[model samples]
Target: MTEEIIIAGFGGQGVLSMGKILAYSGIMQDQEVSWMPSYGPEMRGGTANVTVIISDNRISSPVLKKFDTAIILNQQSMDKFESDVKPGGTLLYDPNGITSHPERKDINIFKIPGAALAAEMGNPKTFNMIVLGAFLKVKPIVAIENVKKGLEKSLPERHHKLIPLNIEAIQKGMVNVESVNSI
Candidate 1:
């Protein structure tokens, strides 16, 4: 099976980091994966996007015109990626950032209060992890245990203690999204 996901937002919002975590977790799971990030000048405050491809078999291309899932952290990201998501693709958007609700009948959309949830978890910086947890809940391609390991491995040594909190944040996000989807 193959899954292509796009994560987009402002540079400091941790969009690339989220995509990298997913790619690294996919690799840990013995899956073929690629994380391609756009290197543009506006990365500081402007848009930043990362494309992650995970597959059980060999990957064909790193570039994508369509994706199975799009995780948008800002309205600009939503506007930019909305047209590119494939029919029946999943969209995980930050409800606070994206003002316009999509009108597409083919694609599925989930509006999450990811940043707020992270702040509620005691670290606003963990917004990316919150959204990452939601992504895991929706996709389930990578095991959460592996993702927790990835979080520990990928983060700096000084931040090791934050892993458990991040894990809890992820669990909270998963529960939040699951409850929303159920209703």
Candidate 2:
């Protein structure tokens, strides 16, 4: 089955990074993938979002109408895309950013405190990784082993030591799986 996901947040919140990880992981898993980020005037502070499509077969369209899943890091994103998600689709929102609750009952919304959890992990920047972990548990597009390998390959050679910490952050997010489907 194919999966389409949108990762949305304000600038500097690593919205693109999460998309990159998803694309990289999909590549590692030998899946057809495409990552499309908003390119027009969103370069400013309006909204930054990326769409990642992973499929076992050839991808038909790069544009997505109903995302199978979403990771919203900011309130604007939550307000903007939560309603557009497909019924039964998953929504992972950063509680630190999103304030409003979704009124839709058809979609599964997981409000993950990724920013706070990353801060507790001693690296506030790892919020993207935390979100990745949650996606791993929910969508599971790629195996954890491939994800680790892709992550190691993506990082600079000099900063390879940070891989373990990223893995830890991922594991911590995974441990909170029960909260994922519920949130």
Candidate 3:
């Protein structure tokens, strides 16, 4: 299977790191993967986005005009990438910073209150992982074991102690995702 995904949000919200973890997970699962990241000048609160493609066979290129899934964390990203989801694809969003909801009818929409949940868990940094967990629950592109390996590979060795907490956040996200019929 081939999945082209775009994860977009503010720069400090772990958008790039999430893509990296996803790419690493694909690699651990023996899948061909590509990750491309983009961010505005401000870097912290400014817009950031990453495109990740995973496939079972050889990938011809990394560029993509549309995506099979779009993970939106904020209203700006929702505005930008909502229409980029392919018909019959998936659109996942975190409602914390979203001012406007996705308006597409051709795709499936899922809501994960990642930021709020992360805050409730007392670890705001786990928000992205929570969103990723929700995505995996909806579309098991890669196994959770591989995702754990991915997290280990992506995080610095000094921060290894947080893996369990991250895993807990992911589990919380998987259970809390809400399927929305429409915006």
Displacement of residue 20 (Cα, Å) in model 2 is 0.9
Q: Which stretches of candidate 2 lie over 4 Å from their true place?
A: 177-183
Summarize candidate 3's per-residue lDDT along 21-48 as a digit string, tens digits. Answer: 9999999999999998864443465889
Which stretches of candidate 3 lie above 4 Å from their native place? Answer: 39-45
CA lDDT for candidate 1 = 0.82
Q: Write the per-residue lDDT of candidate 2 for residues 154-178, one digit (tens) a residue.
A: 7788988888888888877776643
Best by lDDT: 3
Candidate with the larger lDDT of 1 and 3: 3
TM for every model, in the order presented, reads 0.91, 0.92, 0.94
What's the alpha carbon RMSD for model 3?
2.1
The 0-to-1 C-alpha lDDT of every candidate, in the order given, reads 0.82, 0.80, 0.90
Model 1 RMSD in Å is 2.4
Runs off by more than 4 Å, candidate 1: 39-45, 178-183
Clashes of each: 0, 1, 0
Number of colliding residue pairs in model 3: 0
